[model samples]
Target: MKNYIVILLTLITALVSAQSTRKYSNEFMNIGVDAAALGMSNAVVSHTADVNSGYWNPAGLVHLEDNQLSLMHSSYFANIANYNYIGYGMSLDDRSAVGISLIRFGVDDILDTTQLIDDEGNINYDRISTFSTADYGLTFSYARKLPLDGLNFGVNAKIIRRIIGDFASSWGFGLDAGIQFENNSGWKFGIMARDITTTYNAWSIDEEKFEQISGAVDGQNQELPETTEITIPKLEIGMSKKWIFNYDYSLLAAANLNVRFEENNDIFSTSFASINPALGFEFGYTDLVFLRGGVGNFQNERQIDDSENLTFQPNFGVGFKYKGIQIDYAFTDIGDQSAALYSNVFSLKIDFSIFR
Candidate 1:
């Protein structure tokens, strides 16, 4: 078991170091928030008009009618990882809003077996320790209604923190911008630019702790990992419309085009950028009970036989609202159609006016 633990730790370290050189830095932030949004496969950019908008599309925050708070929690990788989020938003006035949000994704109590076998080559359970790896995101968002009717804009100032126990850590900074527009016909359109200024993370590794595992595997950990990581900008465009029937039933349809500036397996791939399309729907009864579903993450997955197959993720969710408070639940998968395990997500939202 000790040998297995050492191998696991080494693999984790290698993966961390490899990420520093990849285009998807700070990926934990991409794991959407709000169960409602996740259930819709993150196709809510055009209609996320609440506190959670601070993450999906800040411009939606301008629609806030009162001070609001939101919370969400989800477990991933068969409960080996925990993702938590909290957010607060309030109208600064009829035309402006401000919000603050924090997100954390972590794996805790990982066995550190680097020191389990000392110089004498003797196994010592007492020397075994544990540590955790986590990533945190703090965002300050501001939104304002533009002079034009049904136009709003927003910006996000983000700070990122990442830790791998006492072995490595990093701090990053970035900016995001978004805009939304609604037409008299009830058509909503939105655009969100993430890491608009190109986020950068600077890492600091403790040589002492690193050395303990440096020799765990030959030809590995011989060099100090890259000290800097960069994340380029990504864009998402969305559209949505809502229809009411019988004065007691309603339906909302939303779609999103997610773009990354690189070639990938997305349905629409190119050297300049790749686009993944998502579609979602929500059915509501008397504006109190809701059911939602979506499909997204289109990709060409490779099979063991070296053939490529199209795959996507499907999500479903339900919500209830009353007296300015809401509860939501979602069944989602972290991996696309290729994986078997699914995660449960839950979220709560409250309007301060509920207390008044």
Candidate 2:
């Protein structure tokens, strides 16, 4: 037990320092997947037990009762960006499971005006072209039950791909590990460590295309951008419990503490770290219909008058399940209690059983 405690502290403290640091690198992957989770302000880490768990806490994949497939889609920034996800999970045996997931976040049809002014000094409308910028993540996960009852651990291998039209592209790799434990009293706890190895993205730029716009702006784009980007490690811990009333109505409440190495506007902050708390609740009736709500993304914002104010985002959602198929919808604010508009997120899940 002492050894375990020491290891835990080491993991937490070791993350306090970062090398080759680039904050918010590979950020698109953090936008999250699954409407059910987004509806809960992304507080489902402890109790995620479906195909989507491949993106949340892969340990939960061990709880899959059968083969499953999941898909989700959402639009952000008033439809300027689109995000999509697909996942599959299957139990290898009573004690192990495997999962695979793919995610894409992209902005399409962006007009490129670099060549608008032709070599002859004429403004040619036809020179304007459209292109897309996108990021993709593919993950493979595996989970196994530990010798200790109710304990499970999982690991993920992630491949990241990013593209900017034909001008630039990058490939990155990372690893994630997670553990989940449930007690006899119906309480659950979990921890997830993301990018534990400090993921790196190495870019390959198109010199010809870059040179065309190198002088478009004075003193900008004159030098090639950094060829390498790094993403530091982050941690999240969660706890949850569920209650059933009259064996018909049920409620599950969960909370998560998200920790980052650098100090920021999170609810709790220090020079070396910051902690953000998220709360989520789901109410179910007859195991067929569900209602969910949550509030998270707490931040300390500086007012126009130089004062600080606390703010957060609120989310709500509904879900229906029947005959192994489930559909969920969520209304959420992508911005952290800012002026940005809300977005609609939808997800679908299907379970397959050999007997069925």
Number of the top TM-score candidate: 2
Candidate 2 lDDT over residue span 278-351, tens digit each: 99999999999999999998899889999999989899999999889899999986454755578899999999
TM-score of each: 0.92, 0.95
lDDT of 2 at 257: 95
Q: What is every candidate's alpha-carbon RMSD to the true fold?
A: 9.6, 2.0
Worst ten-residue run, lDDT, model 2? 1-10
Which runs of model 1 end up more than 4 angstroms from their true locations? Answer: 1-22, 218-221, 334-336
Q: How many Å off is the CA of 17 in candidate 2?
A: 2.1
Please list all clashing residue pairs in model 2, or write none if there are none.
none
- Can you write out model 1's per-residue Cα lDDT over 62-177, one digit (the tens) per residue? 99999999999999888999999999999999999999999999999999999888888899999999999999999999999988898888989999999999999999999888
Worst 10 residues of 1 by lDDT: 1-10
> What TM value does model 1 have?
0.92
